[model samples]
Target chain A: MLAHYGYKDGSGDYFIIIDTDKCDGCGKCVEACAYGVMELIEDEFDIEDGSMAAVTEEHRKKIKYSCGPCKPISGERKLPCVLACSPKAISHSW
Target chain B: MITAGVDVGAKYVKVVLLEDGRKVLKRANGIVGFDILKSATEVFEKALLEAGLNHDRISRVTATGMGRKAIHKKHPLNAGEIVPEVIADAKGAYHLLPAVKTIIDVGAEEGRGVKVGEGGKVKDFVINERCAAGAGTFIETMARALEVGVEDMGPLALKATKAIPMNAQCCVFAESEVVTLIHSKVTKEDISKAIHDAMAGRIASMVLRIGVEKEVVLIGGVARNPGFLPPLKKELNTEITIPEHPQYVGAFGASLLAFETEGK
Candidate 1:
């Protein structure tokens, strides 16, 4: 399942899409996130039947605001969360 | 074989019975109070009695909803599998309307927007977490402020003549705003419309984040509200379909799954 966190308003769609199928529940993304945006959760949707990385409920509500500093609009930099995930399951829709 | 789906929702418990895995047999629901199991058993019993069957005859049971995990295994409501609400909702809507690709479920506590793929697969989904403004409770709370019954709010809102802006995005602040409107002599009808408008706006925004698709279906208890449809239709700019007994769609979907997965 593609779980979209965050919302869309007058500006545009600001969401963090987490593909649970590709995510392996590794804690790498959890530690790499400076804002504590990601966490390992037991994903019931995954066919593999194991935990996976998901955006915390707190960050999901205000994702654009919580991830404001690291947004690509500011400057080009390696996003620690995305970079740490070897499975490449995370992507941002701006 | 007969299968049952138990949807233990926050405000109510819904049960759906299916015969030979595909045909709808009976659907029953009731207000859920302090005892979750008791409420579930009563509703389940009502459905069985209506079908002229006994509890032991059910071959399998699948459960879903906010309170699904809370059900004990020793109880009669014990389900072989506990599926999440989104998957159950998507499956249920798609089964009822195979063409439906987008499903919006607005219950008492939360609202969800699900994007479905072929074969009732869940492609993408969004949930309004920890917020009352996007759910049916928003209307229920506003009804209290206007001294109207929950059922009356919808009809009252249709009588609104002017568009009133309610700026509060949170439920707590919205209540105070409703009180202020009342003190200012604003009619209850207009205030009710504003409440529905605000709620539809929030639900629409969440859905847009994932994108809306054609053949949209609206399920859950709030779909029964007469006032919520107009504003929601205007916001998403698309016609929405509501399945028969929309509140039981989730449970119905689970029953379908129980039948399909019988031998697995």
Candidate 2:
């Protein structure tokens, strides 16, 4: 399941897309995050006791603000999270 | 068919079981301590026990609230179908009063204003997760500062002879201000009113960002505060409607969705 966590309001789309198929529950993104936005959640089926990476509940409602600091003002918007993920499961929808 | 909705809120967990999507079987809630799933299951089991039913009797169980995401496979509550608390709150409030087009839900940790369209669908919402001053925790902290029960904060405010202005909106600063008020011999009642007024201002501003519509309803645990209601009503400049069980609205909405999502 490709879970998109974020809301679209009068502001443009701000989403942190997580591809569960590609994500192997690696905690790299969780470690790389400075804002504690990402968390490791256990999978529903308990397949091999694998977990999945998801945005924390507190940050979900306000993705733009939560993920804003990492997205720089003028520099190359090379986000630490997308760079940290080996499986390339995480992507931001600006 | 029986369906259940479990709401794992920030400060509390709630469970509501519904029969055939219309009739209610039980409502249970308790303080949500550490291990969010454990407390939720305890409350769920309590509701099950009260209803005289087994876990297997519930055909579908949908989970909602701040801690809804915390429900993983290890959860013994058989929680399924993760739904956002905003949606559940909207659905639940709309069910109770179909005319309610706007819902203001201020839980212990967060506050939100949900605009509802036809059939209780969420049209738009503004969530105040960035600030604790806009939530029930603000009063909870102030109540502790005043050395009064949280339940007494509201009623105590009602006795105030004059409205005392609270300078600090942040919970941290507000606590210090309460300490200062104590030193200055400020009555607890006036200070309580100041706390509630500041809290209401923050919440009402959030609702205003979405613009208030007619038939507004207030839900969540804070709705039970008799002192907080008047300030909120005055801030919104409108009459606020509250359900008999305001805190149960989220669970009620989730159960209604459980019934709706039974086959799908």
Candidate 3:
């Protein structure tokens, strides 16, 4: 089933990278990702996403949800949950 | 038997004097003070004088809400300040409406979802202290952004034939959207209605999450809005009872708690 969707390794060595320093944890990326691969984690940073950020299993840090198919509330480039981050803690490269 | 309740809210201080369990005198004032005890004392004294009753005639006193903790620690105050206040709010509503089971208190800065049981006791409650979406401030902010008086919002919203889609999910961002709509020359009535819809939508989402019971009572400052009722009542799909003195609900409930304390 995973192979049929054709998950590509994009731009980075890791499948996903989350900067815990920047995540706000509004959980939009988790809601957006169909694969259920990302989890919002609590980190002590206000500048990233204001409250919580998404962290992947691999622990690599990235910024915002770049998923093309996700429906953002504001039609924002980043999901409102990820855009809400002040520290820039969520990103998925693959 | 004169019992009193002082609801020191974020925007206003409401004091109520109940004479033999009926409201004899009530007052709401917007005062400035860092020391709540002074304000409480001032308001209490004012209510007492207005009712032509001295402090000695008053049986009990109760306090509720965010300022409760502060009032409890102040001079000549007791621990029963907060709990009785909540109980009184529920009790007062019970006296007016025998069938009331749920109380929605949307105040200036926060909102509360209260469920009342037999004998006017609060069964379970949820306080939305972390978010400002359900509070009066949300509408106030939207009113400012839309360039209309908050008091005029309900009537203006009622006149709206269509509602524009507001983009922001949060209160702060939503206010910005209202400002942008104004720049786009959207009708004020439509903007007002949109604001009402947004607020009602947010509160409705919360109410739906908790599962509202029949005979729900809507109270606090936001309950006064005519625009708020239609959408909220539609969402509730039940008859909502709004007391004549809604803003004083927490204070009224506190007074009832005082009566309960005295077993009167």
DockQ of 2: 0.02
Docking category for candidate 2? incorrect
Tens digits of per-residue lDDT for model 1 on B105-134? 999998988989999999888787666777
On the 0 to 100 scale, the lDDT of residue B232 in model 2 is 89
lDDT of 2 by residue, B111-173 (tens): 988989998999888787846777899999999999999999999999988888786656898
lDDT for position B263 in model 2 = 56
Cα lDDT for residue B182, model 1?
95
After aligning candidate 2 to the native by TM-score, how far in Å is the CA of A16 from where it should be? 28
A best-first ranking of the candidates according to their DockQ comes to: 3, 1, 2
Whole-model alpha-carbon lDDT for candidate 1: 0.86
Model 2 regions more than 4 Å off = A1-94, B72-75
TM-score ranking of the models: 1, 2, 3
Q: Which candidate, 1 or 3, would have the higher TM-score against the true structure?
A: 1
Q: For residues B1-264, could you state the per-residue lDDT of candidate 3 as single tens digits?
A: 767777878777777777666755655444527887677777777777777777787777777756666777466544245653346567768877888888888888877667778877788765555456557888898888877788999999999999676645557878778878888888999998888877776566555534578779988888999999887788667788899889888787777677667764
Cα lDDT tens digits, model 2, A22-65, are 99997899999997999999887455677999998767765665
lDDT winner:
2
